[model samples]
Target: MGIWLGALRRPLLRALPTALGVVLLNFALLQLVPGDAVDALVAEAGSATAETTALLRERYGLDQSSWHQLGDYLQHLLHLSLGYSPRYDMPVLDLLLARLPNTLLLMGAALVISLTLGVALGTVMATWARRWPDRLLSSLAFLMYSTPGFWVGLMAIVLFAVQLGWLPSGGDGTVGAELHGWERFTDTLRHAVLPACTLASFFVAVYARLTRAAILEVQTQDYVRTARAKGLHPVRVRLRHILRNALLPVTTVAGTHLGGLLGGAAVTETVFSWSGIGRLTLEAVQAREYRVLLGVLLLSSLLVIVANVLIDLLHARLDPRIRAT
Candidate 1:
């Protein structure tokens, strides 16, 4: 327990500065863009008088200098406020909270599917080593890794939703159905299938290749040789010795991939029209809703930081050497 806590402490300490840096960087980058929320609004409205434009800018604090705006933003952040979204006409934090769960659900489902399938396929590849199964699975993993996720999603929708009529093509659930209890859960799951699979595909390939490599490397270790010499069952040796240690690298890769997964989720959500943070992020970007965009980026940075910290603790638990150090 103390080891786990100690493992967590370092990452938690670094998180604040990391998050602040991300906020500052994103704010600066957004400032480089040509227009503010007002510009987008004005364009959408066809035209606005100079006075109306100025008033809108003042209303949203867009009239201020970049440094001044950033200072005010940091002040609001300190107060746990995410400012307002002119596009959504709501507090940025509130708007994010509403969509956060859908993104989380999509990410969580993708993670589980990727890890489960990747590890299994990797194990098979490792077991077969140089045979047909290993070659076939390796080729498949490479194909998945190279293919674009959005293209995969489009094909999935066309095949499953259009051709076979198996699942809904878009959105997070069936609209106006007033689904309840298990029905609601199942409907949401059905809608999630394509997006989750699309998101998982690339990661599954990555983990599979990584796991196969790690297992092959571990199989050559002295400990593994000794275990085999003891005449243990092949399955026990494979699982308890080979696969367990092989998973350390897999866990590290998974932790680092969270950010990538979030980025991929943005594309996946846009492709499927899923009402998640990713979709909201696209809308915010299109509308030049800097406040909402910044909020999303900040939240994403914190989530990745938190996930990496937890992964560190898990790594410690998995490897006694880490705890001892």
Candidate 2:
């Protein structure tokens, strides 16, 4: 337990500074943008009167200087206040939390699917080495890696939702119908299939390549050779020695990419019309909702930091050398 706690200390300490930087940078950059959220709301409502604008500005403290606003925002942060979303007319934290679960569900499913498929394909390619099967899988992985996520999502929707008339085109679940129990669960899964596949494809490609390379490298290690020399079964040597160490790198990549999947799937979310943070972010950007956008950025940065810390812990647990260090 002490060892695990020790392993986490440095990364957690580093995360504090990273999170502070994200907050400062996001706040300052958004301040530099041309207009405030009040201008957006007034324009949308077609009530651009000076009095109304002034009142809205005053209400949200937009009338303050940038430095004062920054101080206020930092104060709000200290109190766990994410400020209000002028567009939604609600607490920004609440708005973000409401949409967070959907995003987590989507990204989680995609990550699982991608890791499973990537590892399986990678294992096969490694086993095959230079065979036709390996070549074919490698080529396919490259294609998936190069293709844009949104385009893949669009194509999948066209083929599965429109062409085959299977699966809902987008959204978390069917909107009008009341569903319960297994039915609702299956409906959600059905809706998630296309978007999840679209988002997972690129990750799948990345992991497959990473896994293959890692395995190939691990296979040449002294321990692996020693295991083989001990008359262990080929499968046992491969699984217990080579594959285990190979997965260390794969795990690191997965952890790093998990952050990206969580917050950077804006294109896939938009293409699928999924009501995730990415989509909400898109909406916020279009409407110029600075507070909400900043809140999202802060949350995303925190998640990435948390993910990295967890990855370090996992690494310590998996590799004895890491714990010793």
Candidate 3:
């Protein structure tokens, strides 16, 4: 209600300025690139006539001053009218909307797998920290985290798709693979395997380490000591008391990792040719399709903002210390 809104006001206000900054910085960097959209179109058109260049420039409002262009760009951004795409010859937003689900699917599936497996492994390690299994799992996490994304992706493709003949090699579902409703759902999931595992392995490693550390810290706290002294079963004490309290920091870290997983996993998508935001961004870069590139930046920034906000809420709920003004 009003009380929660009051509590959230500061963070919400901070997000506005952060969003504006991201847009401004992203637009400014694009403007600073070596060529303009008009230049790109003209180069591709193969004609250097004055009339044609002038028409092209005017079509995109490039004749305006830098400040004017920036202001206009911001205004369009507010309306979600991200302008036309030079390469695709369609609205930038349209192209992004078309491609967003594929990327989200890949990243989302990977995140779920990584977080689940990671928490399980972490709990086991924390439950038996001094055992050989704990040491072995820790070593494995370290190795997985250190391995490069591309290398792992390539290996998975080689082994799973080519060597074992288990999954498709790359790209979306098979040619014309009924990409709609329930059928496409399963198809996309099937093709998403390599990219997801490539992306998830590193995250699993990081999350396992984080969760293990958090659990270990909670195990040493005074309440945990009291729980042990009481007649409560060890499993119940660990799960309901120690583990729950330890999850606050781990939740915050995992939230941040989730954002990084989506953004940083660009290389994995590119390697797998999964047609996600990462792949879109690469295509935009190669073609100098600045609008699509800007859209990707906006999308990523929004994701990061949303993730941080969710984490803050989760953190506040978990730790009463966050409720203080």
| TM-score for each predicted model, relative to the true structure | 0.98, 0.96, 0.91
Candidate 3 stretches with Cα past 4 Å from truth are 1-7, 41-51, 320-325
Candidate 3 lDDT, 26-66, residue by residue in tens: 88888788877667777777878999788867887778888
Task: Name the top lDDT candidate.
Answer: 1
Evaluate all candidate structures by whole-model CA lDDT and list the values in order. Answer: 0.94, 0.89, 0.82
Give the Å shift of residue 302 in candidate 1. Answer: 0.5
Residue pairs that clash (backbone atoms under 3 angstroms), model 1 = none
Model 1 stretches astray by more than 4 angstroms: none
Best by TM-score: 1
Residue pairs in clash, model 3: none
lDDT of 2 by residue, 1-325 (tens): 8998898889888988899999999998998889988888888888678998999899999999999999999899999999988789899999999999878878889989999999889999998989999999999999999998888988898899999998889998999989999999898888888888899999999999999999999999899889989899999998888887888999899988876796557888888888889999989998999999999999898888888888898888778898999
Candidate 1 structure quality by residue, lDDT tens digits, 181-222 = 999999999999999999999999999999999999999999
